[model samples]
Target: MTLAIPDLPAVLETDRLIIRSPQPGDGPDLFDAVVDALADLRQFPASLPWAMEMPSVDESESFCVAGSESFQARKDFPFLFIDKTSRIVVGAGGLHRPRWTVPAFELGFWGRSSFVGRGLFSEAADALVNFAFASFDAKRVEAICDDLNVRSIRVCERIGMQLEGVLRQERRAPDGSLRNTRIYSKCE
Candidate 1:
């Protein structure tokens, strides 16, 4: 059975960040961020294909609209994480691709190249995980990452999501090679 949307605040604030839904005019800000982080993002070939080339402003706005619509529909929970003080959109992360039948959401994230060393994504993940459980009564929150992505694995671990197992040769990599996926989950 699909779970109904739960009541929650539109914006969530952590000590150093503010997490919120994507807005209509976020295209330019998003365009700048991806442009700034393109090199770093390209490292994960399968993460975002659009990052291969810079998107036009219209493309970015369309992405924002889609995210906003899905969020409003309670189909996916998306968030943009900004530095509370600097107000820079340092990173984006979300509880996405949810299976409300199982009440599980997959976590994914990315940070601007300049913010990688910092723990902003980790902080935001923590907040989102908390909200997912407290607000949505999720039975499981999981993160699936390429087995080779040590950085992503670390983020999942940092948030206390236990390694469930590895799915061998389950996906095709960005370079056309078969890739393994590491599954991590926090269960209620």
Candidate 2:
């Protein structure tokens, strides 16, 4: 089952990064990151539907505000992966589709193209998974990605998430192609 609490910590830190929830006035920076990563992100249309449009600053801010409210209400927790030293949003990810009865959540993440292959997503995942168990009654945490996304699959493996199996032709890509989904999970 999924669980959340208003008093839960907003920021989670690892050795090299700080993962924090959405805050007000984050639109400009958030918008820039999306704009910078648009090209690469476009390749996976199924990820963030809002991101596919390359939203304006106002739109991005609106998104952040909604996210903040969910976090505050203990609905969902979508966090920003911030580089400790550079203070940039290297990537973002979070636990979603919470099943409170089972205390389970699905993990999703993406990173700036420039920071690709740096293991940032893995670091973020490690922290988020720990946060889930420590902050709530998380019995199982999952990370599912397009089967063809080798990078994301690697992130799952790097974080020690075991591959359950691939769901063949499970999703449709932005290019209108049927894609398989790889389901990975980490259980407590």
Candidate 3:
């Protein structure tokens, strides 16, 4: 069964991070993080189309506001990952594309370039996966990424998600070339 939005925890804590839903004032920090990681994000245009263009601070704020609304409506669960000690937004990720009927969710994540190689994204992602299973009673949690994204693949494997398969020519890359997609999942 699907849990009501009110029943969902808006903030989830880890030993070193605070994973929470986006709020109105989060735009500045979110903008900085996105800009810092823009080049890296642009590498997978098909997977991260939103990163193709630089968004204004207002646009980022709009995203936060809309994200909050989506969270409240139970349509999506976008989150910001903040460092516990520094209180800085280190990354962003969440369970998206929910299929409440089967109680499944698609996990997605990305870290600021400065925070890369720190394992913070992995920590946040693990917490999200656990939250999906525990809080949402999700029967299946999956992550799909560009086949060439080694870091993302490692994150999925590190969190014990098994590689289901790769979909050849699943989509087109930014350069108009065929791209493969790797699907990973942890199922009940």
Q: Give the top-scoring candidate (TM-score).
A: 3
What's the lDDT of the predicted structure labeled candidate 1?
Answer: 0.83
Candidate RMSDs in order: 1.6, 2.0, 1.4
Which stretches of model 1 miss by more than 4 angstroms?
Answer: 1-3
- Model 2, 60-129: lDDT tens digits are 7887898899888778888988899999888788899888887899998888888887878888998898
User: Candidate 3: lDDT over CA atoms?
Assistant: 0.93
Tens-digit lDDT track of model 1 for 2-71: 3567676989999999999888888777777777788977766654566677788889888878889988
lDDT of each: 0.83, 0.83, 0.93
Q: What TM-score does each of the candidates earn?
A: 0.92, 0.93, 0.96
Better of 1 and 3 by TM-score: 3
Worst 10 residues of 1 by lDDT: 42-51
Q: How many backbone clashes does candidate 2 have?
A: 7
Instruction: Summing lDDT over every window of 10 consecutive residues in candidate 2, give the lowest-scoring window.
Output: 1-10
